[model samples]
Target chain A: MIGFETLLRWLDLAGIAVFAASGALVASRKQLDLVGFMLIAAVTGFGGGTVRDLLMGRTPVFWLRDPALLAVASAVGVLVFFTAHRIENRFRALLWADAVGLALYAVLGAEIALVGGVAPWAAVLLGVATATFGGVLRDVVCNEIPLLLRKEVYALAALAGAAAFVLLRMHGIWRDTALLAGMALCLAIRAAAIARGWSLPAYAARRD
Target chain B: MIGFETLLRWLDLAGIAVFAASGALVASRKQLDLVGFMLIAAVTGFGGGTVRDLLMGRTPVFWLRDPALLAVASAVGVLVFFTAHRIENRFRALLWADAVGLALYAVLGAEIALVGGVAPWAAVLLGVATATFGGVLRDVVCNEIPLLLRKEVYALAALAGAAAFVLLRMHGIWRDTALLAGMALCLAIRAAAIARGWSLPAYAARRD
Candidate 1:
């Protein structure tokens, strides 16, 4: 049987692939050059975790330490560039992949922050950071408003998942179980919101 | 004589003004709406330190706790929008104002990190965070490559100043003297770099 550490590593790799694929998909839609595609992929794959780790004073960021992550992201970018037209229902695929990536990142972020000795509230914030920052960076690079800031349930879903994770952990749930439960909760919430076209009310006041 | 705490608060406020102005200038260049302008100004003014504090597990982000910072940044945005056409030699003015903001932020970041019991290297990293993140965020919002990533002496100048500040503090230098000396060094370096058109080498390979 594989060790828990090995399973976590695999999840990390899967998360990177999903994020890179989403970024490349976006870039392809924009008709960006190969360099631009790769740039977006890399940023979307690593930007959030990099920011979170830097803030936490973690050194030699994860991708820097594990060069394979870069190689995988780059390969995925290339693949997407050539196969862009082959993917059916691009929007649906992108949304699903993004949801998976968000869930993985949120759980990983919460775990890392908890191990880093951060307070529970801070851990939740870090989880949101992991789930949302990659998309924010991708949107910024593509010159659009971040999806998180839109009248959507994106970040709110992540926050709910994180809070659930913390509460479960407090009640003596096993770590892996808590993480999986949190990720599932986030994925479910995100999927439902997308399916129902659910959205939060815009913060701006309505004009007369 | 002004009290030390009062002086620090004033410096922080001044830094906010300069950073917000720079952000507003970028927004004007992009022809963004008033809401966009305010968003850029607020992010540029407080994004770096907010990330830093969040990572350090500090509560109630700086601007959240002190609403005046938001007021100052908003005022600067409005002022820039109204007077943008009348402003002359904008590039030069922006360069100088940016340098002042960078120096002030670097000093403040280093001080805050030191108080938080971080290592010197981490403190220096936070200094760079304070000085450069606003510009990075602004560029991202404006859909441009961040000035910091373009390999200017920008981050280098901040790092140098941070090192100087930490060194002086280690030798028991008075806080005021150390702060002044460090800020002066960063401002001078950034100004010189701009005047000389200095930049880091591009990532692209050179053709023979």
Candidate 2:
């Protein structure tokens, strides 16, 4: 059986790859230059975790300390840049990849915060940070409103997952089992919401 | 004599105003809607410190618990949107306002980090966060390379100011004197850099 730390590391890697692919696809859609594409990929892959770590006062952010993540992201960026045209449906790919990244990050972030001794509420906030900040940075660079704030279930799903993890822990559940369960729950909810166009009600009055 | 806490409060307020103005100007240039403009202003004014506080394990980020800062930033956004044309030469105004904001934030961030029991090096990093993250976010939203990563001595100036404060404290300087000196130094260096077009060496090299 894989150690919990190793599993978390793998999930982080997968999250990075998924985010890089999504960002590179967006850059390709915009016909951005190679440098721009690389920048977007880097930001999308590492921005959220970096922000969370910085907030948590974790020194030497993961990517800065580990060159492997950057190498992998760069390689993925190059591959995506060249093969972007082969993808038949960019929007669908982006949405699916982004959802995967969001779920993975949400779990990783909450787990880290729990280990770091943060309160359950703060851990949930960190989970949201991990899931949403990268996409926020990507949208900012793409010059658009962050999709996280667009009446979507993106951040809300992450928060729910984090809450589930916290509740399971409080109930003395096994750590690894709780994490996996919470992550699976978040991914299923997010995917279903996206497929059905489910969203929370906006604060404004609804005409219908 | 003004109390130390009172001085810090005033500097924090000034930093918010300057940061909001810079963000509002950028939003105006980008032709963002009122919500977009307010969002930019709020992020620019509080994003860095919020990140810093979260990292330091401080609960309830400064602006989140205090609505006044958000209100002020929104007001500034509205004012800038209406007066954008009148404030024609935005470049000059942005430079000066950004410099003031950077200096004030550097001092405030360092002070907050110290109060939170962070190390000197970490305090300096917080200072840079307070001074530079807003501009970085603004540039990202404007779809440009971050000014800190491009032309300008922005982040470097913040670092220098932070180091000065740390050194003064090490040498037993009064806290107020150290803060004022550091802030003044940052303001002078940043303002002069902008006025004279001084910049750090670009990463590119001359092709032989």
Candidate 3:
């Protein structure tokens, strides 16, 4: 049986791989070379967690401390570079994988912040940031409008998950149960958004 | 008489203001709202230093410790919001001001990294990252290509300044002298790039 911490680490790595594949697919769409694919992939995989750690004063960053994460990201990059052309609907593939990564990272981020002794509200904010910032960075670097700023319910979904995790832990729920529930909530929201075109309304100025 | 640290702080504030202004101008061009202007400005003003501090394990981040910096950035955002349309050439104005901020930040970043006891090479890298990353963040968030990744002398100019600063300090040069010389070299290169169109060659794959 895996220790709780070990299980969490595996989830984190799975999230990283899916996010990295999405990044590499974006690089392929942009006609970038292998190095570009790897660079974008690695950043996408680690970028959110890196930002979360930095804001929370965690030094050396998670990836710098653990080389295996980078190796996985780079391997995914290479694999995607060679095979992305074969995919019929790369964008759809990216969105679904991204949704999974988003859900996992949101719960993980909130849990980490909770463990770090941040306030529950701040933890939830960090969770949402952690879940979405990598994709934001990926889109930004690729010169696309970030999905976060889009009308899509991406960040709202992350926020719901993070907030749910925080609230559950506050209510003395089991940690594992809270984590699973948080991810499920996030994934369900995101999956529905993708399938049904659910989105938050765009900002509208009040007319006098 | 002002202390050296005080002088550096003033320079840092000045750099923040210029960068913030550039960010606000971009926001104006993008037709973002007031909140968007302020958010972009604040991030642009502090993003580079924030990243540098995070990488170096500097806790709380520089801006979080100094609310004055945030206030200044916000003020600049508001100012630019009202006045940007009056400017004849906002792009040219941004370039010049950005060049100044880039030069100052390159030296300051290198100095701080050295003081923090990082290796010279790492310090140089941090310096360049610090000098240009705010603009990169600004461009990225604005949905444009970052100047750093372009076929230009931007990061190269920062690299020269940071390298010169480190080399000068290694030879026991006076801190003031080294700082000024580094800034001068960086500004000169950046100015020439803007005025004379100096640029690095774009990457080209070899033909078989």
The runs of at least 3 residues in candidate 3 whose Cα sits more than 4 Å from the true structure, single-residue gaps closed, are: A1-9, A88-90, A201-208, B1-42, B45-49, B62-136, B143-208
lDDT of 3 by residue, A82-137 (tens): 88877536678778878989999999998988898766777886798788889879
Model 3's DockQ score: 0.15
Clashes of 3: 0
Q: Which candidate's DockQ is highest?
A: 3
Question: Compared with the true structure, what per-residue lDDT tens digits does model 3 show for residues B78-99?
Answer: 7876676664255787789889
Model 1's alpha-carbon lDDT is: 0.80
Model 1 Cα shift for residue B152 (angstroms): 17
Which ten-residue region of model 1 chain A has the weakest summed lDDT?
A199-208
Model 3 CA RMSD to the hidden true structure, in angstroms = 7.0
Ranking by TM-score: 1, 3, 2
Candidate 2 structure quality by residue, lDDT tens digits, A90-123: 6786687777778878877888877876667667
Task: For model 2, state the Cα shift of residue B63 in Å.
Answer: 9.2
For B1-208, candidate 2 gives per-residue lDDT tens digits of 4688787777677778878888876766655655556667877887788868877778546654566676788788777666666654656877787788888888778878987898989999998887888878777766767867885588888988888987798789998899899999999999888888898777777798
| Local distance difference test, each candidate | 0.80, 0.78, 0.85
Candidate 2: misplaced stretches above 4 Å?
Answer: A3-10, A88-90, A201-208, B1-45, B48-208
Q: Which wins on lDDT, candidate 2 or candidate 3?
A: 3
> Per-residue lDDT tens digits of candidate 1, residues A67-177?
899998999889888887885357687788788888888878888877876667667767877777787799877878665655347877788888889778878999989
Off by over 4 Å in 1: A1-7, A205-208, B1-42, B48-136, B142-208
